[model samples]
Target: MAKKQGLNKKLILLDLVFYAILPYIVWNYGKEPFGDYATMLISTIPGFIYTCYRFILEKQFNIAGLFIIGSLALGTMVNLLSGSAEQMIWNGVYLGLFYIVIYFIALIVKRPFSLYFAVDFAYLQGYARKDSATLFFQKGIFNWFQLIQVVFIVRGLFMAGLTVFLLNKYGIDGYGGMLLYKQIAGWFFWMLITGMFIYINIPVQRFLAGQQDKLQDKKTPLSTDEIF
Candidate 1:
């Protein structure tokens, strides 16, 4: 199970890197093989294919797989439609906005997507959802987990929208400049998200584990002064 979880994490990272950077590759390295639209299709299709291949090999997906596959599919759509520099620059904003809606719905329902994301990653380190083992988050901890999703959605929207505005305002017509700008800005946003996730997720997970144990009469919840 540990091996499978680690493999899942690695697969997700690879997919993110491949899908996230493919546009730049298409605009540069793949430019000669075909034009922009063709190259976009060429680059993105294989990523989805690879994702499918992983599912085939694993025979089942980790909980995070749903969102990972959704992201890949959405990315493929945006890449395919973004044939021009303008489209490439702004399509991502559209996708981000779309996600804001979905994430907002998650918030409304009290099941933030980031909570699932956190649990899935923790699975790599041996966390489990089974009631007999690692306990899932209860109400209070789940609220904190939702905060993670809120922070993520807000940050993603701001960064993506800001990028679109900056590109258009400056008239960055070339793929090179646009892609470079996205790469740098993307790293910035991801860094912020990682930091925020750590701050928000860790304590909540610990609390949830403690609460579960107490309720189940396992170890019983104990006080810890240093809990963040």
Candidate 2:
């Protein structure tokens, strides 16, 4: 259990740094290599490769992998078309639009894409408890998916809209002048994500913990791993 938890933490840190912090760092400093367009390409490439490699290594093609590939493609297009700081950031905006479309489609299908992404990460894309997690997600303790569906859609839209507003007002190059403001806004988005995760999933965890306790008290031979 400790080993798995450590691996999970490492995976999460790798993903966080590559997906968010690294790109931000590169974009903040990469202009020294060539220029803005090159920096944009450089910023996205490492994360894209790392994510793809992780999926290949695990032999699991999941939603997160798909998003990474899609972002890379989008980022490449943005790099090719970028004539200004705004164009450089359009790719990220496109990514937001993609999520918006995906979230709504999942809701239409009554499956809620947010649920899949969360489960995938929780298991670190391993086979362990995947089907069980899917079952649990579909059975959905606390009606978590139903509750979070609207929040996911609205939040995605709000984030995309806010990012566009910032990019337009500040310019991608606004990092040059208003770097702290951009960093603070970036942290705001991260906090929003963290808050939403806790608010939406804590009930599910609590309920599961309750179930585990019941199983313990009943002296059932079954473990939570089996119930997962």
Candidate 3:
């Protein structure tokens, strides 16, 4: 699982780099490839293909796959119709919407997506002798996962909106301006999100674990109590 996660991380990083660089390259050398629209379309294809490959490797047959497919379709459709910078903006919007939907689906199913992380953490805690065993259904972890999903939803929407606004205001010609704004906003948003996760998530997990420890410590010894 750790190896899978590491591979996923690498793929995501590569995806980010591809998107960030390709747009600039297309915007600059668009004339050679039947103009900007064609260039943009061609450039985006590789990322779409790579994302599909990643999904296959990850064996994500659910909403994660749906999200990627939906985003690619929406982005391609936007480009086909408008052939404007707004298509680029739609890319972000579609991705944000995809994650938001996944978050809600997980919540409604009562199997919060954060269970993945919670289970991992619980295993680590148990291994460290901090707890007897892992309990993924803990209320504290559920709450934290809900909170994080909310944060991601908000951040995703903000990013999508901001990207649209930038594209509308500057067009594809303003690569330098767009790049500068994107970099600054991207860094700021990531830092803020990371800080929130650490602040809220870490403490909640610790608090819950501490409660479990206290309860264990107060329990009667097996020798003193009759087995049922």
> What overall lDDT goes with each candidate model?
0.66, 0.66, 0.62
RMSD, one per candidate, in order: 8.2, 7.9, 6.5
Point out the worst 10-residue segment of candidate 2 by lDDT. 175-184
TM-score, structure 2 vs. true: 0.59
Residue-level lDDT tens digits of model 2 in 71-170: 6576667667776556656666776788778778888887765566666666674545566365446454526665566676776687677677767787
Q: Estimate candidate 2's alpha-carbon lDDT, on a 0 to 1 scale.
A: 0.66
For residues 78-151, write the lDDT of model 1, one tens digit per residue. Answer: 77668764575578777888888988898888777776766666665665645412333566556667777787
Estimate the TM-score for candidate 1.
Answer: 0.63
**Deviating ranges (above 4 Å) for candidate 3:** 1-16, 31-33, 56-66, 73-137, 175-219, 222-228
Q: Write the per-residue lDDT of candidate 3 for residues 1-228, one digit (tens) a residue.
A: 999779757754675666566656655677465765576666666667776777677555333345567767776676666565445556556756777787777777765544454444445444431241234356765566666666666666777677778777876666445655665676667666556555755756687789899999999587735655
Ranked candidates, highest TM-score first = 1, 3, 2
